[model samples]
Target chain A: MPTLYIDLMSQPSRACYILCKKHGLPVDVQMIRLDKGEHKKPAYLQINPLGKVPFLVDGDLRLPESAAIMAYLCDKYSLPDNWHPGSSSSSGQAAAHQQQQEQQRRAVYESAVHWQHLNIRAGCMRLVFHTVIGPRVFKVPAVPQVAADGLKVLQQALKDMESYWLGGGSRPFLTGQQVSTPDLLCVCDLEQLRMMVAEPSQPQLEQLLAPHPIVRQWMAAVRAAVGPALYDEAHGKLAAAVARLAAAAAAKPAARL
Target chain B: MPTLYIDLMSQPSRACYILCKKHGLPVDVQMIRLDKGEHKKPAYLQINPLGKVPFLVDGDLRLPESAAIMAYLCDKYSLPDNWHPGSSSSSGQAAAHQQQQEQQRRAVYESAVHWQHLNIRAGCMRLVFHTVIGPRVFKVPAVPQVAADGLKVLQQALKDMESYWLGGGSRPFLTGQQVSTPDLLCVCDLEQLRMMVAEPSQPQLEQLLAPHPIVRQWMAAVRAAVGPALYDEAHGKLAAAVARLAAAAAAKPAARL
Candidate 1:
């Protein structure tokens, strides 16, 4: 059995949590509350020097980064053949070609995952921080210029997702007909954005996603695939945190002054 | 044979070039010159809409990003078993565990590759641009503040690499005893810095690498493994470009005015 140290409010943590549930991998889920500054403490720092969420401890190996954790689980558990086609046991030239194609698919998946770190993940986190988190949690007033810049980057990323990655052909996901790791990773980032924008206090954030129909449809599909029970279970803490922030913001307007 | 579109000056492009040479993969090297604004031109833009170097064009697959290109080559060519342990043919729990460890190794590789995009790569690029490129190529004076900031970030990344990733092990390379793709990628970025710092005009840049003996030794090992002829061949264009830039800077004394 492995122990996963995670904070539900973190986008990658939610992705890893949902991935484990979706695959039926039984493991201990240890919550590290980010809002309570639990992740920054010395105990957590000893576990991960970076003090980040989505760290995995299995036997002798301790791993951080959600992408790595997801890959480890897929390999260690040998979960279904569709998740990674290269893992399939087949031979011949046709098999070779299939393996090549699967490798290409994985390359694309890896590229997107890597690109998301600076683009989607960074942009969304900045946007959320500037518009909501900074003001609500830290009592720092919103910086409209920074928020707008973040929104612009997010919009371009959404457009790229549609035109370059997903909009090609009739494939339902980032890689193919099946829901792969990249899809799960991407959807969780967008869900974080969706959570922030759903708040009545942030109408400007809502308009950023309004023109991207493809992004909207893809999010809905990912949500349905994860299933409501698991999706809610994974995202429930984040939702509660957002609600608390909103209530706190409403309660003390003078704190900003 | 696949066509690899690259600019040798670009760090990732250099990695892919060296990897292909090391593996003896027959590839048509097509240079997209960034110094001449060739990458930004319409012809190159059609090949890669992102207008980035290190794009790979195999029969039908047009892949961008060095990590993706490297993985595809490793898969399609079916190179040595050590390059990618998970791709090896084996059976049972021990094999499964080996595969798991390999995947974990790869995950760390992936995490570093992704982190480099924003940290080492971005920081080094900014440092180079602010200290060298801006003044020489663009005729723009270096802003001390921006250059200092970039230097600070680069120094911190090098420290983290030593303390967190490398200091834990006696392994020669990033993953293990064998040289892996992540090693190629990281070494190339460091090589870019080395090229810039080697110049007589950039004493500050040279000082940055002086304290890190581990990084220096690891770099020497990677260069030796890559061998002299192939390594120099891959980096020749970039070296020449840097020289020309330096000569041009000397020629135009009053450009800053």
Candidate 2:
């Protein structure tokens, strides 16, 4: 079995973990605590010099980056095409026409993945780090200006998803009617907003997502496809983190000397 | 023939253009002048919606994002496997061992591409935009603080490339000894720093690159692999733009009446 080194608190790590679980691919899941800086340790760096989570080791292949890991898993396990949407026949005898069709599907899928990396994921991760994780977990001071800039990018990304990717609900998911790796990658980042609010109502996430109903619809579809059990399990650590932050915030005034 | 809408001034556009030229792929290269807002115009928006340069149209498929465009072109034209490194045999009868090796290569390639998107490409583009393009072309005021932050990112990216990706010149190219799409994508972004300095001597580019000798060496290999003639042609417009910027900067004091 391949070994997946990840922290569920990390969005991409959770995405990869859920992907494996969703497919019943038996693999060892090793948690690398980001709070303790385990990812940057020399041992982990030996395996993955990039020092990032969601590192996959299958035989001699040590792959880092969630997008690549998910892609490799899909191909290796022969997951449903809808989940990734672009695998040529292993028989190598796929007709030219069918191969062309697969190429187009693969290209569309790649476009979504690339777009997510630079836009949705970048924006959301920046915002969440500035507002929630950095302040609460790392004790890093939150810069309001940086957080504001992050919000702007996040908003633009949400708008673009509604207008371009979803095409005003014309497509059931980002690339097509089925949820793919891009959807998983993006939705996980957006889910990080759950930590943004002090209250459990998650007003911040709602407010940001309200105008982009199509994005909301797409998120619902992706969550449903991944199934509630595994999806919630994937986000369990994040939920706990958010609760801890909320509790700390609530106790601050009452405990003051 | 497929149509590639691009502006050579755009790094990814030039990368795609050069890839097609290198492979002798018959492609219709159309210019979309970003300075003139051509990419954002309704006609172009109708096709790409993402409103980015290096948009490719092959038959019914309309692909955006440079990484996707390059990958699709590589597959559609059946470019050398080393250029991409993970294409499965079309006959699909390859042994499991060979297929596994290809998957590993492809995974490594994907990791490089993903890393470039967020690290090297992001840092270089941000720095260039704030210091060079934004002030010069868009008439947007340069934000020194943002430029400083961009420089930090660019510097860290260079260091990471040297230590992690290049492994102190251990590997010839990003993924392997052979040149691939990640090399093209990253090298083009680094090339943008040429527009930063005012004098003929690109001190800014040189100074930024001086510490990371491995990255510089890898860049030389990518350029050699692409060959000078086509590579020069691909960067023609960017060179012209850089010249214009230099001329404008030189005349700034004298033009003040």
List model 2 lDDT by residue over A41-85, tens digit each.
999988788788989999988888899999889878888887775
Query: In model 2, what are the clashing residue pairs, if there are any?
Result: A90-B92, A91-B91, A91-B92, A92-B90, A92-B91, A92-B92, A93-B91
User: Model 1 over residues A1-257: C-alpha lDDT tens digits?
Assistant: 99999978788899889988888898799999876778889999888886778898887777777877877777667776556544443444456666677666766776666666656775686678677777765577766655655676677777777766675435677766777777777777776764463245654444766777777777777888789789888888777776775676566666776
TM-score, prediction 1: 0.84
- Residues B162-248, model 1: lDDT tens digits: 666665447676666777777787778776765464244654434766887777777777788888788888889877876675676
User: Which residue segments of model 2 deviate by more than 4 Å?
Assistant: A88-90, A198-203, A250-257, B198-203, B250-257
Q: Choose the strongest candidate by DockQ.
A: 2
Ten-residue stretch with the least lDDT total in model 1 chain B: B84-93
TM-score for each candidate, following the candidate numbering: 0.84, 0.93
| Chain A TM-score of each candidate structure, as shown | 0.85, 0.92
**How far off is residue A151 in model 2, in Å?**
2.3
Per-residue lDDT tens digits for candidate 2, residues B139-161, read 88765544555676788889988
